[model samples]
Target chain A: MHMIQSVGIIGCGALGRNLFHNLKPLEGLTVECFCRSIEKDDSLYQSSVRKIEELFHCDLILIAVSDQDIIEVGQILNAYSGIVAHCSGATPLHNFNGKGGVFYPLQSFSRSVIRSFKEIPLFIEGDNEETTIQLYSFAQRLSNQVEQLSSEKRQKLHLAAVVSQNFSNHLIALTQAYLEKEGISFQALIPLLEEGLGNALYQNAREIQSGPARRKDTKTLDAHLSLLKEEKRLLPLYEQLSESIKTYYEEDF
Target chain B: MHMIQSVGIIGCGALGRNLFHNLKPLEGLTVECFCRSIEKDDSLYQSSVRKIEELFHCDLILIAVSDQDIIEVGQILNAYSGIVAHCSGATPLHNFNGKGGVFYPLQSFSRSVIRSFKEIPLFIEGDNEETTIQLYSFAQRLSNQVEQLSSEKRQKLHLAAVVSQNFSNHLIALTQAYLEKEGISFQALIPLLEEGLGNALYQNAREIQSGPARRKDTKTLDAHLSLLKEEKRLLPLYEQLSESIKTYYEEDF
Candidate 1:
C-alpha cells in the first residue's frame, strides 16, 4: 500500500475547502492547513506559526491560493524539502523554482456542491522525477485519469478551458441578458441550451456548426442584426462573431 | 393509456434519427421520415420524397430541420391538417398555421450515437389550445421535463443557446486550433472541458468564473498574450474575450 501520511494545505478558500473536505475522508492521510483564519478542530492536524516553516514536516504542501500569491508562497515554501504543489490551471511548475510541482484538478469547484473526483482528471506537473512519481501516485488515488503534463501543455489546456467554460458561460449570460431585455423568461431557452451542449459530445463541433453566419445566409444574418440594432453593445458582438463564423464556414457554403 | 400510432419526421438528420430510433421501440408508435436522401434504409420507413402530400397521412409529423427550412416545410404541411410540428429551438408554432405544434427535444442529438431521451427535456409549442395540449401530452411520454413555450420566447431561447452552446463550441474549436498549431493535443483539455460543462449544472457561472482575464491579473494575462503574440488571429480573440471577462467582473473587482 502506498503511504501518503501528512498533507498541509495553504489557503482555505474554495479550492482548499474542497480539497480538505474531500481528502479528510481518505484513509492513511492526515490534512493540515495554514489559513489566515484558524479554526479549532481535531481534523486539522497542524497550523503554521510561520507559513515557510509549515512545509518542513508535511509530505505534500498544496498551495490553493490566487495566482498572484503563488510565487510569494513558493518563495516562502522553497526553504523546506517537501513536495510543494499548487492547484492552478495556468501557472507553470517552474514558477516554484524546482522546489514544487502542480496538482491541478481540472474542475470548477464550489463550496456548496460536492464534486466527484473519481473520474475527474488531475493534471500533474513536477520539477523532478521523484516528485512527479509522488504526485502521480497521489492523483491516482483520487482519480483514474491522471497524467503528467508539461507547463506549456497545461497552459494550452488552461486557454482551452477559458474558451469552453468561462467564455461559454459568458455567452449564456449574454443570452440571458438579451432575453431579459426582450421580456422573455430565461427558462424558455433551457431545452435548446441542453440540446446544444448535448450535440457536441457525439459530433465534432466543426461539422455541427449552424446559424445564419454558418450558412452565410446574409438575409437571416441581416434580420438577426436588425433585431439587435437597438442594443448597441450587443450589435458589435453579434457582427464580429457572425463574421468569424462566416469566415470559418466560408468553404462549406 | 396514451395511444400513439405513428410518428412522421420531416428532417432525417441527427435530431430526426434520434427521434426515429427512440420512438421505434415504443409500444404503439411507428416512425416514418420524409428525407432528401434515398440512402437511408427503406426498411426503417424513411422516404426520400419531398412532397408534403405524401407525408400528410401520419398522425404526428415532427419537423426536425433548420430554422430557414421550417417556414417552407410548415407552409406545405399546413394544408394537410394532421398534427404538424417541428423540432426547432427558435421557430414559432404560428409558422405552422395552427395545423401544427412543436415536439422540440431539449437535448443535442447525433445520428452516430444513441442517447436516452428519458432525461432530456422536451419543449412543446402549438398554434391552438387543442394542439398545445396534444403536444404536451406527446412530449410527456418521452421526457420527464416538458414545458410549453411560445414562438417569441423560443426565439429568445434560441438566441441564448447560440451564446451558450454554439459560441462556446466555437471557442473550443478556436482553442483547439491554437493549441494544435503549438503541437499540443486538444484532447488534453477534455477534463477541463467536462468539468466546465458539469459545473454549469449546479452553480451560476458568474460566481465560478476564474482566469487571468477575470481576475484582472495583467501579469498573467500579458504573459498569456505574449505567448500568442505571433498568432495574429488568436490575439484579437484573446484580447476581446479577456476584455469582456474583465468588463463583467469590473463591479466586483
Candidate 2:
C-alpha cells in the first residue's frame, strides 16, 4: 500500500469542490474537505472536517485555497509528514516547504460543470525529485497527459493561460455586449467562435490570422472604426490591436 | 430546372477558396473560382477572366474580395441579370443597389483547412423577399443553421464576431508568445483552452469566470503584474482587462 491513500483538501472553492467531487469516486482513495464551517450533508464525500488536525491524518493533503492563503496553509501543514500539494498555475511549489508538490490541472474548473480529465494535461511541480515522481504518478491516475513543469515554466504557462482563457473570454463578453446593444442575439456569433477556436487547433494561428487588420485594408478598418462612434473607449483598443495585427502580418509576410 | 446550376467565386483568397472548396462537392452544385493569377496545376476549377461578362453565363456569382473592391464588383455584376452576392459580414446588402444580396457565412475561414458548414450558422440578407428566401434555401442545402438577419443586425453580429473571433485569436497569439518566451510549448495550454471554451458552450460565460481578477486574489494578480515588468506596453491592457473582468463578475454576481 502507498503512503497517500487518503486525500485532504484545504479549501472548498471551485477547484477544491471539483477535486473533492472527482476524487471521491476513485477506488482506494478516501476524500475529505477541510472547511471553516462543516456542512451537515456529507453525501458528496466521506467526511468534512473543520480542523486541520483532523485532516493531518490523511497521507496526501491538497491545498486548493486562494493564492493569498497558500503560505498560511503551507505553514499549517508543516507538521504533517504526508505529501502536500496545491492547484495553482501561477504560484511555485517552494511556498509549501516540506515534501510539497503541485497537482495543477492545466484546465479551467467550475463547480457547475465537471470536465473530463481523460486527455486534459496536469502540470506537476515538486520540492524535490522524489516528490515530483510521486505526484506525477498520482496525476497519471486521473489523466493520461502529465508533465513536470518548473516554477518558471508554470508562471509562463499561467500568463499564457490568462491571455487565452481570460482575455479571450473577455473578448467574447465584449461581443455579447455589442450584439445585445443592437438587439441581436449572441447566438449568431457561436458559429464564428467555434470556427475561430477550431482553426487555432488545426493550424498555426499566426498563418491563419485574417480580417481587415491582417490585410491592412485601411478602408474597411476605417469604416469599422467609424461605426464604433459611440464606443469611444473601445476605439483605442481597436486601433492599437489593428496596428499590432498589421505589424505582425507585415513582419511575417 | 433552375437557371443557377453552378456558383462562381471571384478572388481565390481565404473566403473565396473556402466557399469554392465547400460548394464544389455538393451533389447538384458545380463551383468555379476566378483567380487573378494563373497557376499551372490548380486541382480545382479555375478561371482567369478579366471581364465579368466573360463569366456572365453562370447564374450565381459570389464576390469574396476586400470591402474596398465590393462596389466595383457590384458595378461589374450589374450588367448580368443573375443572383449576385458578397460573402462579407460587415458590408450591408444595400451597398449593392438592390442588384445583389449578402451571403455572409458567420464563421472564420482558412484556405488550408476543411471546415464543415453543417453546424456553422449562415446569416443571410437580401434586397428582396425572393432573394432572401433563395439565399436561405441555398444556405440550408449546405448548413442546417440559417437565419435571416437585417443589415443593422448583421453589423452588430459582425462586431460581436470581431470580439469572439479576431480579438479572441489575438489573445491566443499573445498566450503563445508568452509561453514560447519561457521555453514552454503552448500545447500545454490547449487542454485548458478547450475546457474553458467547452464550459462556456453549456453554461453562461458570466457565471463560470475565474482567475486572479475574478477571485480578487491581489497576491496572484500582483505577481502576474510583476511578471509584465519587462513588457511594459502590455501592462495597461492587462490592468484594463483585469478591471473589466472584476467589474463584470461583481455586476453579474
Candidate 3:
C-alpha cells in the first residue's frame, strides 16, 4: 500500500470542495484544507485553517484556486517542504518555483451536479520523476484514467478541451436560441445531438459528418443562409462553418 | 396489431440501407426498396425497384433519397395512389404536390456503422390528419420515440440539428488538427469530450460551460490567441467563440 498520510487543499471552491469530498472518504488519507472564507459546512470534511503556512506540514499540498491565484498561492507556500500541486489545465506548471506539478481533472463541475471522479480523466505533470510517481499514485486513487503529460502537451490538451466542451456548448446554445425564436421544440435536436456524439465514439467525426455543407448542397446552404440573414453575428458563423465544410470535402474529392 | 403491410424505400444510400436492415426484421412490416443502382448485395433486403414508379403501388412509399433528389423523386411519384413520404430533415414537405409527408430519422449513418432504430427519434409530418396517423403508426413499428412536427417547426429543427451535430463535429475536427500539429495526443481530449456530451444529456449546456472565456481570463485567452498566430483561419474562430463566451457571462454577472 502506497502511503499518502495527509493532503492539504487550498481554496474551497467547487473543484476544491469536490476534491475534499472525494479525498476525505478514502481510507488512510487525512485531508486538511485552507480557504479565505471558512464556511460552517466545510467543517464536515475537516477544520480548514485560516493561514496558508499552517498547511505546509502536510505530505502533499494541492492548490485548487483560480488561475489568477495560482502564482500567488505558490508564492505563499514558497517555503513549504511538502510536495505541491495545482489543479489547472491551462496554467503552466513552471509558474511555481519548486516541487510543483499539475493535477487537472478534466470535467465541468457544478455544485448541484455531483460527478463520480472514478471515470474522470486526471492529467498530472511533475517537475521530476519522484514527484511524478507520487502525483500519479495520488491521481490513480481517484480515477482509472490517469495520464502523465508534459506542460506543453497539457497546454495543447487544454486548448482541445476548451474547443470540445466550451465551444460545443456555445454552439448548442446558439442552436437552441435560434430554434426557440421560431417556436420549434429543442427536443427535436436532442436525438441528433446524441447520435452525433455517439458516432464520435466509433468513428472520426470527419467521416461521419452529414449536412448540406458536407454534401456541398448549394441550394440548401443558400436557404439556411437566408434564414440567418437577420442575425449579423450568426450569419458569418454559418457562412464560415459551411464554407469550411465545403472546402474540406472539396479538398478530399 | 399495428399494420404497416407494405413499406417502400427509395434510394439505397447509407440511411436507406440502415432503414432496410431495421425495418425488414419486423414481423408485421414488409420492406421493399428502390435505388439508383441495383447492386447484388442489396438483393438480401428484398428486391429493390430500379425505377421509382414501381414503388407507387405500395401502401407507403418512403423517398429516402438525398435532399436535392427529394423534389425530383416527388415529381416521379406525383400520381401515386398511396402515402408518399421523404426521409429528409431539411427539405420542405411542400416540395411534393400530393400524398406526401416526412419520415426523417435524426441520425448520421454510414455503411459500416450499424445503429438500432428502436431508440432513434423518427420525426413524422403529413399533409393531412389521416396521413399523419398512418405515418405515426408506420414510425411506431420501428421506433419508440415518434414525434409529429409541422414543416415550419421541422425546418427550425433541421437548422438546430445542423448546428448541434455538424458544427460540433467541425469544432472537434479543428481541435484534433490543431493538437496533431503540436505532437499532442488526441486521446487527452476524449475524456473531456465524452463528459461534456454526457452532461448535455442531463443538463442544459449553457449552465455548465467552462473555460478561459467563461471565466473571462483575458491572460489565458491572449496566450491561446498568440499560440494560434500562424493559423489565421482558426485564430478568428477561436477569438470569436471566446468573445461570445465572455460576453455571455458578462451579461449574467
List the candidates ranked by lDDT, beginning with the highest.
Answer: 3, 2, 1
lDDT of 3 by residue, B102-141 (tens): 9988777877666899888889999888788999988998
lDDT tens digits, residues B1-253, model 1?
3344776787877887788778777776766777766464554444345565777767778888876788777777656766888887655565465557777775566667778788776778877777788778878888887888777666556656666666766766666667667786666566666666655534566666776777788987887787778876567777777787788766552
Model 2 segments beyond 4 Å from truth? A25-30, A95-97, A112-118, A251-253, B1-8, B21-33, B44-51, B94-98, B112-117, B250-253
- Best-fitting candidate, measured by lDDT? 3
C-alpha DockQ of every model: 0.39, 0.57, 0.61
Residue range with the least summed lDDT across 10 consecutive positions in model 2 chain A: A37-46
iRMSD values, candidates in order: 2.7, 1.9, 1.7
RMSD to truth, every model: 4.6, 3.2, 2.9
In model 2, the Cα lDDT at residue B39 comes to 69
True contacts kept of 3: 0.66
DockQ of candidate 1? 0.39
Measured with C-alpha atoms, the lDDT of residue A165 in candidate 1 is 66
Query: In model 3, which residue pairs have backbone atoms overlapping below 3 Å?
Result: none
What's the count of clashing pairs in each model shown? Answer: 3, 0, 0
Fnat, 2 decimals, each candidate: 0.46, 0.62, 0.66
